[model samples]
Every structure is written in C-alpha cells, then in structure tokens.
Target: MADPKGFMTTPREEWPRRPVEERVRDWDEVYVPGALLPIISKQADRCMDCGIPFCHDVCPLGNLIPEWNDLVAREDWRAAADRLHATNNFPEFTGRLCPAPCEAGCVLAINQPAVTIKNVECAIADRAWEEGFTPPRPPDRLSGRTVAVIGSGPTGLAAAQQLTRAGHTVAVYERDDRVGGLLRYGIPSFKMEKRHLERRLEQMRAEGTRFRTSTRVGRDVAADELRTRYDAVVIATGATAWRELPVPGRELAGIHQAMEYLPLSNRVGEGDLVVSPLCAAGKHVVIVGGGDTGADCLGTAVRDGAASVTQLDIYAQPGADRDEDAEPWPTYPKIYRLSAAHEEARDLVTAPAADADARLFAASTLRFTGDGSGHVRSLHLVEVDAGRRPLPGTGRTLPADLVLLALGFSGPDRTDGLVDQLGLAMHARGTIARDAGFATNVPGVFAAGDAARGQSLIVWAIAEGRAVAAAVDRYLTGSSRLPAPISAYDRPMAV
Candidate 1:
C-alpha cells in the first residue's frame, strides 16, 4: 500500500458536489466540475487491500478496488487505470453511474465510511484519459468471423469492444437516433454528462467497433437476415418496458411515464427542439414511486420550475443503517439514503427554496381525479402498511397537475415490432430467458443485460456483455480466449 498507516491515520473525505443553487440553473453535469480533482489519496490509502476482498465479491464487475486504490495512492494513475480497465471496459460510465456496491461491501465499512473506491476509480479513469494513458488495443491478427450486437447500451458497447479487440468484425445496432442506448437518453445529464459516454465511444470506435444507430433489427433488417450475415449475434437490448400504474385517469393529458418525461428533459439539454414536449414547469408534479428514478424526476422538475413536487413511496421509510434481516454486510445495505434530489427537495420544501411539498412514505395512490377538461388536476392518496394495504381513515385528496409513474420497469419492450416479429420468448416476468451461455431457445441468438436479467446495475450489464462476447466467440470458433467475467449461471460468489 502507498501509505502503510494510511487507514489508521487518515479520515475519509470525498470530492465536493457543486452547490445545488448554482447547478439547478443549467443542464450541465452536477458533479464533474468540482468533483474530479479531489482524488483524496489519503482516503484511497484507507484500503486494507484485504487478502480476500468482499468489495470485489459485492461488485457485479468484481472490480479490483484495492489494486487501483493502491495505485492511485501511489500516484501511479496510469497503472491504476490499467487495473481498472482490466475488469471494466468503461470505468468512465460505471464510475459515474454505478451505485458502488464495492464500497458497501468494503470490510472497512463495517465501521468507517469505507475506502473511497468509486471516487478513486473515476479519478484514475479521468486522469488516464487526460494523460494519454488510454489507447486503442486493436488486434494484431484478424479472425474471419463477424459478430452483430443488437443494442448500444453498456452491455452492447462492452461486448462490441471485447469482440472487436479479439479480431472479429463487430457492429452495434441501436434503435434510438443515437447510440449509447439509455446512457444517451434515459439517464439525466445532471448526474453524469454525455461527454464521458462520448469519449468512451470514441475509444471503442478507434479500436474498430462499427456503430449503426437509428436501426432496429427485425424492423430495419430481418432477424434471420442478420443471423445469416453475421457469424454470431448477441442481443443486449435492455428492458425498456416501463411498469405502469393501472389507476383511473391513467390515459389523461399531463400524465406521463417516467421515461417519457426524463428523456424529453435530457433531449432539451442536448439542444433538440421540443415537439409536443412534456414540461413540469409551473405545474404541481406528483411522482409515484420512491426509487432512484423517482428522485431523478424530482430533480428534473425542480430545475424546470415546477410549482410544487411531491414523491410517494409505497414502502415505509428505511433505516439510516442496515437492517439485519434485509441487508447484511458485504451485501448492499437497505437503508434510507438522501439522494441529491431529495436534498434539493428538502431545500425547497423545508427551507428557503421556493417550492417543495412532501415525500410521503408508505403512501399509495387510490385514484386520480380529473377535471371535466380531461386533464389530471388531483389525486386520492392513502397511507399504507408494510404490505401496502390501505390504512383505515388515511385517504386524502392532493392537488396534482402532473402525475409521473416512476414505479420502475417491468422488462424489455416485448410488444415492439422487433420482439414481436422475431418471436422471442419472454420469461413469466417479461424478461428474455437465456441459458448459461446467454443463448436463447432460438439457435445462434443470445441475450444479456437488462433484456434478460430485468432492470439491473450498469456493472451487471457490462459483465453480462463481456460474458456474452466470450460465448459468441466460442460458438463461432469452437473455442475462445476472451475473459468471461460472468456466466449466466453464475451468482455472486461468497467466501
């Protein structure tokens, strides 16, 4: 380790976030400006570099936290980036987007705040790109085989990069106008800017991954035609099916899905023209669901000058620390955490900020009441127990000009022309079912990421991508040397 007594001597300190008041004015990334420089080497030096790291076990990617932390502490940032890239193809993306299960799994976190593993990893990646440490690792010899990846999300990108580097011609297909899938659209720029994704895409391009956006397989091109053209096909199409609430007034104007609202704001940030736009401006916005997606909506609406915002969660508020039965050490904790959005909302509702109403936990929506004009104007809500059954005498009416269902996704868009025309089988839960090698029942076709696993972490998506690439390579060549970071049959390993 860089500092022998670093863990004992230094307390953890992290990069500071930009002041909320200043950041909400614009759509620029909320953290990057002031977040990168404070590498907090002393904090990195806190890593024990344990003989058997639970952090790795907890992380879906199994990132070498201690190795990179030590490298960062020693000021060997290039080597740190190398170690980081060994497991994660796009640390820039994961560094920004992932919730850092590794930190939660840290042995040190049993007491202290744990090593700043995620921050160190992101810092190393940023520094590497700045110092010209990252370069394309083009294959020396070409394999005559070709592979097609159907989806340009993290999974597709990683699979394409790995396959392209392994000397196979690879093409990534995205249905959206641009590549990067959800990264390009679903995710808001406030948490992570588009530049991180763009830079990584540039690297993948240099390494010879051909990208074909605005193209949907089984629509633009027949599924069978793609199979005949490519040596192998990997489906990384993520779960895009939004879980809808079936309450009354569901189809009314001013009621929108979370994806619909989030993407429009993101697109607006991208300088795109608003066509029949969904704006939260000067409206009383009520978001139903208490997950990160809901928090994201809260932030976006606040920035858009929503007259008021209220978030509702069906479950009771979680504890500030781990609950024994729910989350144990080395597993991610189930606890009440205040996100930046929650903080901003608190600032609005409780303090000086102009507008914020409430975040009602254990609250369930009974129904939406609409004016005769067919626009949503209010909602009937009730308090509920842990089982989400309504409590007696808890019903009340709340003003709601706009209701966003942030309840989360059910699975991929199975009804889309692509899945329907191809006749892909979905699991009972609506996710595509794949075997140990990520192969679907359909021969020569494979699935991975959220499309197969349902809504999941970015780390899992990338791991699934790398694993699927290995499977595809082996299928085409009858053997493979690619790193299989995960297999469909593999679960999180425990000691």
Candidate 2:
C-alpha cells in the first residue's frame, strides 16, 4: 500500500502539458519538461491498493500497479523499475501511448479521480534509464533452438527479448528500413521521440537479438525458407491495412489515409524529407474520425501551421462525466476529455459557439467537393440526430484544402503474400486464427500482436507478445517457466 489514507487526502495530479502556443512552435513532446518528477511521488501515494485491485485485472500486461505505486511513494525507484519490467517489456511505450484502461478500472474512480498510474509508470521507466538500472539481461547459456519473429513492433520486440533472455536464439525481421514498425514511423515525434525507441533497441541488441531491417519476409526472403531454417516462427506484423471511405470524389489529390500522411511526417523528423508531400501548411484541413489517430492528425496539422482545422465524429460527443447508468462501476466508460492536441486546437477557433470545440459530433460527410484540378476544395457535411439521420436544413460546407481519413484499420496487410504463403486461417473478424495456446494450425508456427488481435493498443500487443513467447518456449523445450500474461481471447478496455 502506498499511503493508508492518502486516497482521501491527495487529489489526482497529472503531468502538465506545455502551453499550447509554445508547444505548437516545435515538434517536441507537448509535456512541460521537468514538471512531473517533483509531484509524481505524491500522486503515486494516492493509490488505495484495494483488496481487489481491478487495475491489475484490466491491464493487458497485468502490471503490478499497486506494488510499483508503493515503491514510488517510498522513493525506491530501482525496485519499482524491477517490478515494472517483470511484466512489461517496454513501459515507456505504454506510459506514453496507451489510453491507460488500468486507471478506469481503479477502485478510487468510483468516487474520486483515479490515481495517476500512467504518469507514475512513465516516471519510473524514465528514472530507470537515467540511473542505469535497466541493463541487458543476456541468457547464461543457449537453448540451441532458433526462432524467427516477423515484424519489429512492440509485439515482436517483446517476444524476441523474452525468448533471448530465456536462452533461445531470436531474429526479428522488419519491412521498413528501421526496426520499430509503427513506433518508428506511424507515430509523430511530438507524441514520443524516436530516441526512446532507439535506446530500447540498443538494449535489445546487446541482449543478442538479431534484427534484419529493410527485409520483407514474403518477398525479399521467402517465408517458407525461414520456416525451414528456424525451429519456430512468430508473426507479429501489425494491422496496417487501413479502412477507406468510398464516398463520391474519394480520389481527390489532397485526400489521403492517415497512415500515408503520418509516416511522411515521421520521415521528415528523421531528416529524410524537407517537407511531407501531404503537408497541411497554409491549408484548411478537415479530419474524419474521432479516435486517437484523429487527434494525432490534429496535432500534426496544427504543428504544420494549417490555416484551420476541424474534426468530424459520426457518433455524438461523449458526456463530460461517466454515465453510471450506461456504464456501471469497473467498466471503462466513455467520457469527454481534452487531449494535448485538442487543447492545442481549442486555441485556434474563430467560428461561432457551434464550432467552438474544433470538433463536430453527430456529423456525417455527404461528399467532398473538388476544384477543376482534381484537388480537394471543400467538405460537404450534414448534422445528424442520434440515429445518424441527417437533420433538415443542417447541410453546410467547410473550406478544406486537405482531407485526412483516420477511420482506423480493418485487418492485417495481406498484400505482402505472407499469409498466403503460410496458408494460415483467419478468424471471423479477419484477424489471424490462433488456438488457446496462441499457436496457429500449422505446427511450430504462431502469431501475436495486432496481426492476431486486430487493431489494439501497444499494451495488448506487448502482453500478447509475452504470452506467445511462453507458448513458443514450451513448444520448443516441452516445458517452460516463462510467464503467460494473457490468452489470445483476452481483450482489454483499449483500442
């Protein structure tokens, strides 16, 4: 337990973001630097460490939230880092990227604001790196078995690290030029700089995990060849095939998928390009979708100096507070909250009260209007009721020189021909089919992460990676001691 009566006395305090005006000038992270360390211990003390710690139950990684919270309160960062890394291979990634479902399941959330679990987790991870407490744990001896992991995202990285430390030779292959998949390209530097990823990859390399970059498994190297050479293979390729909107004028020049635009910006951060082809500079940008991806686009566009920005949501805006009747205790509820990007966009409003939020809820896109050059000119939309039926006299047009589709993903990208090569079966939801043991029908072949679980949070990806690694170890050695955090069917309250 952190502090016996601290939950009642200490109010929840989170890491503060830099002022919107100041943060918009640069592509660095939005948080106010050095503001978290002083107050994080007090915030960690707010954890009740309840009899039934639902925080652990909801976390896909099954992280020891209470134990770490107590350690942080006592200023024992080394022990807290150990407890954190015991389950999560990459706490820094989750602390920055995850939506933190553990906080939603907090017992304190029933009455008071939940403990700042995510911020404390980030603090411990950052401190560990600073104090050199996080060192490469190389295996004492080799197991004489080989494993090939497809993809270098969180899942593949976790599995490779776990297996390597457990005395197995592991090699990770990535299609991109760099090792980190979405972590290297899909996310912007402002959200989390690539240095965090680079540091972790350095540790993995020291632990003897071989990485093969710019190598497509099905094309550059045959998948069948890898299966023949290695004793076992694990597929962790993420869900990259994006969902599309097939409305009229969908082929306009200025319209693109979020993945297309985001990766370009990330390349610019890597010094590969001076300006992204889909740059929103000096343009009126409109984004379709109201999830975290949309918010990411919003922030990127704002930093790029978009003349104006508006986000569209098909569903109605969530309530400011949790609706208990709709979602009772222990269930993650949908509530309105301002993300860093939302806060930045809120400062750029010039319209009337209706458009003050820079977001339009119950909004449906009728079609896009284009100029003579086949470039997007404006967006045609209509306000809708609860059922999404367009209301009478609610049609309007907004200037939009650029349009981005952040409408999420459908399934894994099969264009690589890997799935066809393996003859793997897919679930009804279009994800890879896996049994309770996280193994596919093909013997010695397994799948994990978004490739197996569909579009989800990094936390779930890491958890599935750890679990699948244990299954693979057991298959290789007949018996294993690795911890399996969750089964393939275990879904958490996260994207």
Candidate 3:
C-alpha cells in the first residue's frame, strides 16, 4: 500500500493547466509540460489502497489503480507502467480523454478529494516511453490464423494489438487516409497532441500489426472478400452517425454538425488545408448540445476566434455537489463541473450570456433566424423545466452567425455498406446486435465498441476492444489466455 497515513495528511493537487492566455494562442495541449512527473508521486501516495478498491471496480478497463498507485508511491516507475498496461492498451489516450469515473468511485472521495489517479496513470505512461520500458512484444511464434479488424479507432486498435501479440496475423482497415479514425480527425490537438498517437502507431507497426488506410471494407473491398481471406473479422467501426437537430432553419448555410466542423479544423492542423472553410472567426457561435462533443466544439470555436460563443443545455445545470439521494457514492454523478474549454470561455469573456459561464442551462432552441442571404443570423430559445417544457415569458434571441449541433451520435454509419453486405443484425437503437461472446449474426464475424454499444466513453470502447479480441481468439483457437474485462451485455453503472 501507499503511505499509510498519507491520505489524511495530503491534499489533492491536480495536474496544472497552462495559463489561459498562453494556451489559447496555439494548438498545443492545455496542460503544462514536465509538470506532472514532479507532483504525481505525492498524489499517488494519497491513495489509501482501500480494502475494496472501488476505483478499480468502477473503471471499464478494470485498471489496477491501487497496484499502480502503490508502485508510483514507491517510485517504482517500471512496475507502475507494467501494472497500468496490464488492462489498458492505451493508457495515454484514456488518461487524456476519459472522464475518470474511477476517481468518483475512490473511497477517499466519500468525504475528501480523490487521489489523482488519472495524472498518475499518464505520468507512468509517459515515463515508460521515455525510459524505453514500452517495447513491441512480438509473439514468439505465429498461430497461422489471420484476423481482419475493420476501423482504426480505439477499439479496432486495441483488438488488433491484442490479437497480434497473441500470434494472430492482424490487419486493421481504415476508410480515412490515416489509420486513426476520430482520434486522428475528430479530436482537437489542444486536448491531446498527435505525437502521442503517432508514437503508439509506430509501436504497433513494429509489433506486426498491419494497417490498411483508405480502404473501405464494403466499398473499396468487399466485406466477403476479407472474410474469405481471413479466418475471422471484427468490426470496431465507431458510432459516427451524428444525431440531428431537426428544428426550423437547421438547413441554413452557417449551421453544421459538430463532426463536420471539428474534422475540418483537424485537417487544417494536419496541413491538409491552410485554413478551415468552416472557421468561426468573427462569428457569433451557438452550440446546441451540452455534452463533451459540444465542449470540443466550444474550444475549437474559441481557438478560431469566434466573436462570441454560447452553449445551450437542455437539462438544467446540476448542483455543485453530487446529490446523495439521486446519485450515490461510487457511481458516476452529474454535477456542475468546469471543463478546460468552459474555463477558457469564462476567462476570455467569449460567451456573453447572462450566466457567468458560457453555458445556458435548461435552454431549449425554438428556431433559428437567418439573414436574407440564407445564413443563420440569430437563434430563438426559451427556458425549459425539468420535463423540457418551455417556461412562460422566457423567450429570447441571440446573435448566431454559426450554429453547431453536438447532440451526440445514434449509431455507426451504415452508408459504408459493411452492415448491409455482411447481413449483420442490428438493434432498433441502430447498433449492431451481438451475443455475450461479441459475435454478430454471421459466422466468424464479431462486433464490438461503439458499433455495438452506441456512443460511450473511450474507456468503454477500449474495454470492448480487448474483450472482443479475447472472444475472437477463443473462437479461433478453441481456448485462449487473453483477458476479457467485460461481456457483451455489460452496461455502464447507473442509479
């Protein structure tokens, strides 16, 4: 265990972010570089290493939180990295992207600030890379079986890496020109730099995991062709069919789905374009959703020099503290939290709404008003109650030259034709149907990740990836040693 009495003596100090003024000027990550390593060990020592270790139980990856915390507290960086890598294939990604439900489940969090588990994980991962602890672990011998993984997102990457390390010849197909799906295109560099992803890709390539870019499984190459050539196929195509806001004037020239706007900015960062055509410079921007994607859009718009920005949330703002009655301890809770983007918005005065923060809680969009040229000029909205019913005498209009819909995704896009060609059974919710073993209706074909689970946290996607890989390995070899963290039927914790 970590320091026996450290929990009582130590107060939690999170990894510090770069000053708002400095970070907004460039596309680099928000956190201060080289600052985490110095403070991470002390934070790790704060872990009680509880008898129950609810932190580990709550993580979708089942990350060995206590083990790594103890390792870090002892300054055993190598062992901490090993323990971290045991369940998580991509700790660096999760460390940056995950919401850290584990922290919420920490025993210390019952009455005090939780240990900085996410920061510790990231420090271990980065130190491992710097110290040359993460080498490609190529299999000793080939099993002579081959697997084709469709998509190159977190799930597909995880499954391919696991199968490759298990001696199966694995090849990942990506429709995009680059191997990473959303990680390459959708995520902003300010949140996570691309260098981390590129380094991992290099490691995977060295480990014999092959990548096929710009290859659409059902279009460029038939899905059946892959099935005939490979012994098994796994679909990890993430849920990317974004939900639409069908209110009036949604078709206006200045309005776009969050996905459509985010990728263009990413492409600009990738040097594909000098400037994004959808750049929000000098425009009054209004985002229509309150989720992570909306926050992402908010950040991107701010960086693009939006004249003003406002985020509308259908649900009322949650309280500052978790409601013990509605959401008990150890379960993920809804509370008023300030994201880095929201902090930037508040700091820059980029959002001129009545609220101190850029977000308008319990706000419902009534309609969009457009200029005579057919570009959106303003948005009409009303205050809504818990039931989303409009409140009387609360209607208002705000200047909105650009409107982005970040309402989240419904399911994997079927336009790629993979689902139809493979005759995969789908749920009414638009996700692929899978059994406990993560197998689709077709023989030798399996589905996992957002394709089967709908949109969810990145940790869940990686967990599903690892689980599906184990199931595929079992199906191929009759018996397998790979660890499966969760079953197909597993769901996120709820009240």
Candidate 4:
C-alpha cells in the first residue's frame, strides 16, 4: 500500500461538483474541472489492499482496482494507467458511467466508507491521456482474417478493438448515423461530455477498426449473406426495445418513450439542429419512471425550459442509508441517491421535491387526457401500494403537456429480421440466449452485451465483449490468447 495507515487516517472525500445553481443553466459536466486531482491521491491511499479484494469479485471486468489504487496513491500515474487498461478497454467510460460495484464490494464498506476507486480510475485514465501514454496498440503482423461486429455500443466496440489489435480485420456496423450507440445518443453531456466518446473512437479508428454507421445488418446487409462473407460475426445490438405503459390513452401526440426524447437532446448537444419529433421545451413534462433514465429526462427537460417536471414511480421510496436486512455488507445496496440530474432539478424547481413536482415512489400514472386537438394536457394517476397495485379512491389529475415513458427497456430489438432469420433462441426473460462461450446455436456467430446480457452497466457490457471476443477468437483460430475476465455463463449478483 502507498501508506499503510492511509485508510485509518483519511476520511473519504468525493470529487467536488459545481454548485447546483451554477450548473443548472448549462450542459457542462457537473463536477468542477481539475477538482479531482487534488484529492484523488489521498482517496486512493484509503484502499486497504485487502487480501482477496472483493471489489475485483464484484466488478464485471475484474479490474485490477486495488493495485491501481496503490499506484495512484504513490503517484505512479503511468503504472496506474497501465494496470487499469489491462482488464478494461475503456476505463474512462466505466469510470464515469459505472455505478461502482467495486466500491460496494470493498471490504472496507463493511463499516467505514469505501475507497473512491471509480474516481481514482478516472483520474489515472485522464492523466494518461494528458501525458500521451494512451496510443493504439497495433498488432505486429496481420492474421488475414475478417470479422464483422454488429452494433456500435460498448460491447461491439470492445470486441472489435480487441480483435483488431489481435491482427484480425474488424468492421463495426451501427444502425445510427453515428457510432457509440447509447454512449453517443442516450447519455447527456452534463453527466459525461461526448468528447470522451469521440476520443476513444479516434483511437479505435487509428488502431484499424473499421466503422459502418447508418447501416443495418438485416436490412442493408442481409444477415445470412453478411455472415457468409465474414470469417466470424459478433452481435451487440443492445436492448433498444423500450417497455410500454399499455394503459388508457397510450396514443397521445405529446407522449413518447424515453429513448425517443433522450436521443434528441443528445443530438442537439452534437451541434445539430435535430428534426427529431421528440423535444422537451416549454412543456409540463411528466416522466413515468424513477430510475436513471427518469433522472436523465428530468435534467434534459430542465435545460430545455420545461414549464414543470414530475417523475412518478410505482415503488416505495428507498432509505437514505442501506437496509442491512435487505442488503448485507459486501453487496450492492438499495439506498437513496441524489444523482447529478436530481441535484440540478432540485435547484431549478420549487421548495420540497414533491412541490418541485419530481415526486417519487408514491404514485402511478393511470392514463393521459387530451383535448380535441389530440394534444395531451393532463395525466390521471392513483396512489400505489408498496406492491405497486393501485389503492382505491386516491385518484388525482395533473397538467402534463408532455408524457415521457422513461419506464426502461423490455428486451433486444428483434424487429430487424436478424433474430428471426437466424432463428436464435431467447431466454425466458426475453434476452438473447447464449451458452458458456457467448455462442448462439449458429456456428460462426456469437452475441454479447445488452443484446445478450440485457440492459446493464457499461462495465458489464465491456466484460461481455472481452469474454465473447475470446470465445470467437478461439473458434476461428482453434486456439486463442485473448483474456476472458468474466465467465460469459456466470450469473451476476441480483439486486
């Protein structure tokens, strides 16, 4: 460890965020630039370097967290960056977007606060980029084999980059006009700026990974014909199919899925005048889910000048602190969180969170009301039990000019004819079915990420990509050298 007693001496300190009032007006990242470097060293020093680090166990990437934490504490930025990149292809993405399962699994989390592993990881990666230590690791010799990867999300990108570096010619296909899938489209600039995604894409392009955007495999390139052309294929289409509300008045004009609304804001951030049908400006916005996506909608609508915002959830509220009985130590917990979007919304709206209109865990949307013009104007809701069932005689109505179904995803988008053409089996939960090696029933094809693992964290997607890449490599070459950090067959810890 950098300092033996660092964990005992220093209390945990988080990266500083810009004052809520100041940050609410713009789309810049919430954190103050360069504020983390000052405290990251001390934060990393708090790592106990415990025997058999459970943080590693909890991470889907099995990232060398403790080792890098120690290196950061010692000011070995180069070494820390090297160790961090060993298991992860894009530490910056996980460093920013991941919820830090490692921190939850930290042995120290049994009592005191866990080490700021995610913050330190981001610091090391950022320092490496500044020092020009991150360069394309090109293969010494070409293998002369070609691989086609479907989707440009984290999984397909990871698999493509690894395969490209391993001497195979890899081409990544995306249905969107640009690459980075959700990273480019669904995520907002305030949480993490798009420059990070662009930089990584630049590195991947330089490393010899070919990209084909605005081209659907099943539609543009016939799935069967495309598979025949490539030596191997990997699917990472992700879970783009949004779950629906199936309630009365589901066909209102101003109502939309969160996927539809979030991406339009991202498009505007990309410096384009979006002709998108979904834009949240000067409207009474009612979001019907209370997860991360809901928070994202809250922030985007606030920046877009929504007249009012309200987020409704079917479940009861979580406690400010962890509930030991429901979630024991070394496991991820259900606790109250004040996300960056929530903080921004908190400042922009009225006094109490309820008055501010982002009410959580106590209500459910029953139906939408519309005028003769077919535009939504009000939303009817009823109080819900802890089980999310409606209670009698508590119905109420609120003006809602726009209704965003931030209810999250249901499963992969199988409408493109890829799954039907290939006849791949799906799990009972509706996610793609893959065996031990992430291989589908088809011989030369495999699946990973949300396409295979369902909607999940970027870290898990990257882990699945690396694991599936190893499997594909082994299948093609009859042997492989790629590292499979996590078993594709292994089940993750349940909430």
Q: In terms of lDDT, which candidate is strongest?
A: 3
Give a tens-digit lDDT track for model 4, residues 1-495.
988899899999999999977787888988999999999999999999999899988898889988999899989999999999999999988888889988989988888988999899999989999999899888898888999999999999999989988889999999999999999999888888999999999999998999999998888878998789999999999999899998888897899989889898888887776544566677888889988888888888887878878888777777767788878767789777778877766667721436333655678888888999999999999988877788999888878888999887767897888888878888888788888888988888899999878788889999999988898888888898999987766656655
Using all chains and alpha carbons, the TM-scores for the candidates as numbered come to: 0.95, 0.97, 0.99, 0.97
lDDT of 2 by residue, 112-173 (tens): 99999999999999999999999999999999999999999999999999999999999999
Task: Compare the candidates by TM-score and give the number of the best one.
Answer: 3
Clashes of 4: 0
Clash pairs detected, candidate 3: none
* Per-residue lDDT value at 12 in model 1: 81
lDDT of each: 0.83, 0.90, 0.93, 0.86
lDDT string for model 1 (1-495, tens) is 788788888888876777878887877766747455565677788999888899988887778888988888888888888999999999888877888888889988888788888778778888889999898888898899889899999999999998999899999988888888889888888888898888989988888889998887877888888888987888888988898889887877888889899888888877785532778888889899888888889988988888888888888877778765667787787677777777777866721222233578888988897889999999788999988799999887778899899888878885546666556788899888888889988788889999898888888999999989889989888898988888786765333
| Clashing residue pairs, backbone N/CA/C < 3 A, model 1 | none
**Cα RMSD, each candidate:** 2.3, 1.6, 0.8, 1.6
Clashing pairs in 4: none
Quantify how close model 2 is to the true structure by its C-alpha RMSD in Å. Answer: 1.6
Per-residue lDDT for 200 in model 3?
A: 94
Q: For residues 147-174, could you state the per-residue lDDT of candidate 3 as single tens digits?
A: 9999999999999999999999999999
